[model samples]
Target chain A: MPDLLSPALIMIVAAMAIGPAKGHLRTAVLLLAPLITLWAIWQVPDGVQGTVKFLSYNVEPVEGSALRRLFATVFALMVFVGGLYAFRLARWYELAAAYAYAAGAIGVCFAGDLIVLFLYWELMALFSTVVVWCGGTPAARAAGIRYAIMHLLGGVVLKVGIEGVLISTGSIEIRPLLATDFSTWMILCGILINAAAPPVSAWLADAYPEASPTGSVFLSAFTTKTAVLVLILLFPGEPVLIGVGLFMVVYGIVYALLENDIRRILAYSIVNQVGFMVCAVGIGTELALNGAAAHAFAHIIYKALLFMSAGVVIYRTGKTRCTELGGLYRTMPVTTICCIIGALAISSFPLTSGFTTKSLISLAAANEQMVWVYMTLTAASAGVFLHAGIKFPWFVFFQRDSGMRPKDAPWNMAAAMIIFAALCILLGVAPQWLYPFLPYPIEYEAYTAGKVVFYLQLLLFSGLAFFILLPLMKRTETISLDVDWLWRRAAPWLLQQGSRGLQPLLVFSASTWQSLEALSKRMAVNYLGQPETADSEERGLFARSWPIGATALWIAILLSAYVFIYYTD
Target chain B: MSDSDSQDFLSRPQTIRRLWWGFSIVLALTVAAQLVIYVKGYFVVDGWFGFGAVYGFLSCLLMVLAAKALGYFLKKPADFYQQDEDDA
Candidate 1:
C-alpha cells in the first residue's frame, strides 16, 4: 500500500536482521521475509508505481509488469526455499549474503529504469561473491576474486552503456533497444557476460562448483537468470544473440562432457540450459519471449534442485569428483530420485517442466522457418539429455559402487528438493497455470501426441547413445580449459615470460643509468675543477655545492639564449 | 557386510541385464509410436521416419567423441589451478 515499497527492500532488511538474529529468531526472519516479499511483489499494480527525483532525472525504483512479477515471484520463492534448505546447516553469514543476493535479483526484476537496474545488478554481484567465499576454501577464495573481477568489469561496461543511453535519449526508462550502436552493444556484451555466454562463460563453472553446496543453490538461481530477465526487458530480437546462444549451447555440452566434478558438470549445464533461453530471447517472437521467460522460471527451479542434490552428496561425502563417487542411489534414495527428476526436467523429457517450457522455443524457431537454428536447437536438446540428463545422475549416483555409504539429505534439505521437484512435475503437467503468467497470450500446447512421441524418441535414444558410449564417457579427474585460461593461465604466463625476456634489458638499463651518473660526475669534476675525492661522500653531481656566481652566470646565459630564440622565432 | 549382501538388487548382474532389455524395449516403443502418430517436421530431413531417434543418437555420438577428443587437448590435472595457487 505504501509508495516506493519495493520487495527488494524487505529481503534486504531481513538480510540485515538475519546477521544479528539467533536460533529460532533467525529461522523466523529467514522464512517469513521471503513470504512477505512475495506478497509485496504481487501487491504492486501494473506499470510504474514509484519514482523519486535524483539529480536532474526521475529515478523509477518500482515498476510492475506481468513479466517482472513473474521473475520477482520466482525469486522470492527461491529465497524461501533456498533459506529452508540452508538455514539448519549453513552459517548465518551465508544466509545473510544469500538473502541480500536474492534481494538484488528481485530488485533487478522491478527496476523501472536502467540506473536502478544497474544498482541492483551490482548488488547481486557483490553479495553473490560473498556467497562464493562462503565455501571456506582457498580455491573458493581465489574463484570468488575472479568472479568478482569479471562481474565488476561487466558492471562498468553496463554502466557506460546506461550513461550513453541517458545522454543520447535523455531517458533511463527500461525499454527494448537493438545493439545497433556503441551503447547498446556495450549493454549486450555486459548482459552476455552475466548470461555466461561464450568466451567468458568459464566463470559460471569456475566459481559455482567451488561454493558451499547451500551457497551454490542460491548462486545457481540468481545472477544469470537476472541477466535473462534483463535481456527480455532490454534487447529482444537481437540477431547476434542467436549465434551467441548457439555457441553457448554447444559449448556447455562439450565442456560438461569433459568435466569430472559433479557440481561443475551441473554448472556447465546451467550455461547450456540458459543457452536455450538466450536463443529464445534472440528469436524475439511473442512465443519465443514467452518461452524464454517460462524456461528461465523452470530452469531456476530445476537447476537449483540439481545443485541441491549435488550439494547433499557433497555435504555427506567429502569427495566432489565423479571419479570418486558412485552407487549413491543405494543409500541416498531420496537425493537420487530428486536428482533424477531434476535431470529429467533439464532433458525436457515428456511430462517434465523442461518439455513443457523448452518446446515453445523450438516451436517458435520452427514457426519462423529458421531451419538451421531449429535443427541445432533440436540436437542441443538431445545433447542436453546426454550430458546432463543421463550423465549427471549416472556418474554421481548409479555407476560402479564406490563402497561408501553416506547419509541422505537432512530433513530440511529433503523438504526443499521435494518442493522444487514437485514444481517441476506440476508445471510440466499443468503448464496452463504458468501460461497465463507469461508476458504473452498463450496459443501453444505442449502435450501433443506427435510432440510427445518426437521428444521421447529424441531424448530416449540419446540415453541409448549415452549407455553405448559409456566407455568413452568415463570420468577422469581433470578439468577442461576454457576462455578463463586466457586470464587464469596464459596471461600470467605471458607476463612471467615478458619479465623473463626483459631481464637483460632491465640489467642493461640499470648499468646504463650507472654509467650516466658516473659520466655526469666525471664531466662535473673535469669541467668545474671540483675535487672528486672531496665529494666522494656526496656520491652524485647534484649533491655537491656549486658557487652562486657560476650558477648565476649560467642562468643569465640560458635566459639570453631563450630571449634570442624567442625573438628570432 | 559381504559383497553379495552389500550389492543392491539394482546392481545385481541379472537385474542389470533385465534393465538393459527393458530399456531397449522402451526405446523401440518410442520410435514405433511415431508410426501411429504423424509427426510434422519443419524441415525436410526431420520429416523422415525415426528422424528424431537417429538424429538424437548421432548428435550425442558426435558430441561424446568430440568431447573425448577435446579432452586430450583441454583436460588438465584436477589440481592444475591449485598448482597456480601454490606458485602464487
Candidate 2:
C-alpha cells in the first residue's frame, strides 16, 4: 500500500500551488513545505512504503533505506535553507521550479524502480531548465537550451538502457549490474553523464554559472550529487571508473586554476569534489561506499556555502569576475568569515565537515593498497586548496583592494550561510550523527592526530604554492576551451560550410528539373498535335492537359517495353 | 579602538610583515610535525620524509604551469560563444 503522504509529494503539491498562491501565503508554503517534508521523511520506516503496479510492472515509489533516508533528509534541508536564501530575491516561478526540482531529487532518493527513477529524473531536467532560464538574460537562455539538450540526450540514453534491461531481464527493478554486456554498459554511461564525467562534463560549468544567484544555490546542491548517489547504488567497484574519476579530478583543478569568474571557479571545483566520490565508488569497498555517500552529503553543504557567498557578492556588487573583485573583507566581514569557513571545509581542514567525511575515501584507498589512486587523491586534496580553498576567498575578498565596499549579505542570506556554516563544524565535531546513516557499518575513525597533521602539512604547502605562484594565477578575461567547443564553435561552423558547399548542387538540380519539365511540355504539344494554349503553359508540367488517346498510346508503349523486359528476364 | 585605527591596523605594512612571519612559523611547525607523528603510508614513495608537502608543492607548480601552457591554445575572449549567437 502506498503511504498517503510521501515526502516528495508534499513539495510537488506545494510547487503546483505556488502559481495560484500569492504574497504571504506563498512565502509560508515555500518555507513550511520543506520542514513538513523533513518530518515526513523521518516518519517513513525502513522498507518499501509505496508500491503500485503500472503498465503491468510493479513500481515502488518509496523505498526507505538508510542511504535513501540520508539523501532525502539532506535534500529536504537543502530546499528549506535554499528557499530561505532565495525568498526575498527570486521571482515566484523560479521558486516554484526550484521546489519542483528539489521534489524530483527527493523522489530519486526513494525510487525503487527504473521507471519511477526515470520519471523523477526527467522532472528534474524540466524544472532545472526553467530555473536556469529564470536568470532572464540572453546568456542564461542560450546556456539553458544547451543544458536541456544535453540532459534530454542523457535521458534518451538512460531510457534506452532501461528498456534494454527490462527486455533482457523481464523486470524493471533497479539493481547493481556488472558492466558485462551492452545493456549494463549503456546504463553505466547514462549515469556517468550526470556525474559530470569528462567529454560531457562541460555542461555543469556551462550552465550553472549562468543561473541567477539564488538559482545557483539550489542548482549546486542536487543534480550531480544525485548522480553520485545513483552510482553508489548501481555501479560500485567498476575498475575503469578509477581512471575516469582521476581524469575528472585533475581536469577540474586545472580548469579552476585558469578560471577568472568567481562562480566558474567554484563550478570547476564541484567537478573536482565529485571526482572524490566517484573514485570511492570505483574502489567499491564497504568503507568506500560509505565514504562516497558521506562525501556527497558533506559536499552539498560546503559547496552550497561557497556558492551562497559568491551569490551574495554577485547580488550586491553586480560583478562576478575575480579580476573585477577584491578587498571585500573590509566591509563584508560576515560573508568573508563564512566564505573562509566554507573554504576550510572544502579543503578538508581539521574540525570541518570535509575533514570528517573526505578522509574516509582516502583511507579506503589506502586500505585496499591502491597506492596510485591514494597518492593522486592526496595531491588533489592539496590542489583543491589551491584552486577553491585559498584561491576563491583570496581573489574575491582579500587580494589587492578593488575598493568596492558593497554591503554584506542581507539577513536571510546570512542566515542561510550561517546555518550551513554551523553544520560544517557540527558534522566535523560530531560525526556520530552522520555515521549511522551510512549504507554500511562504520569501521573507521576520522580524527587521528597523524592524519590531521598529514593533511595540515599537505594543505598548507599547497597554500604556500598558491602564494608563490600567485603571479601566474592572476585573473584574466579569458575562457578556456572544453569539449563544448565541438558544439559551440565547430558544429555550427561545419553546418554553415556544409550548406554553403551544397548550394551549387541544389541549383543544378533545380535547373535540370526545370529543363526536363520544359522538354516534356514541348513533347506533349508536338505529339498531341493541338495548339498550345495559355492555360497549358500556366498549368505547369504535371498539371498540363493531355488527350485521352495520346495517354493511352503512351501507356501501351510502356506496357510493350515492360512485356519485353519480363520475357528477357 | 576607533574605526580609523582599526582600518589603519589592517592596512598597515606591519600587518603584512607579521602575517608573513606567522606563515613561516606555521610552515616550519607543520614540517616539524613529521617527527612527532607517524603517518602510515600505503606506498613506498608516500612514506618518505615530507612526501605530502613536496608532492603538493611540486604538483601545484606543475598544474599552474600546465594551465599557463594550455591557456595559449585554449583561452579565448569572454565573448567567444557570443559570436555564435550573433551569427545565428
TM-score of each: 0.91, 0.91
What are the per-residue Cα lDDT tens digits for candidate 1 across B1-88? 3475336798777888999999999998989987899887778778778999999999999999999998999999988878997988
Task: Give the per-residue lDDT digits (tens) of candidate 1, residues A313-430.
Answer: 9999998999999888888999999999999999999889999999999999999999989999999999999999999999899888888899999999999999999999999999
What TM-scores does chain A show, candidate by candidate in order? 0.90, 0.91
Best by DockQ: 1
Off by over 4 Å in 1: A504-569, B5-7
Q: Which ten residues in a row have the lowest lDDT in candidate 1 chain A?
A: A532-541
Error of 1 at A325 (Å): 0.4
Report the lDDT tens digits of candidate 2 across residue range A235-258.
889987888888999999999998
Q: Candidate 2: give the TM-score of chain A.
A: 0.91
Real A-B contacts recovered, model 1: 0.87
Q: Model 1 compared with the native: what TM-score? A: 0.91
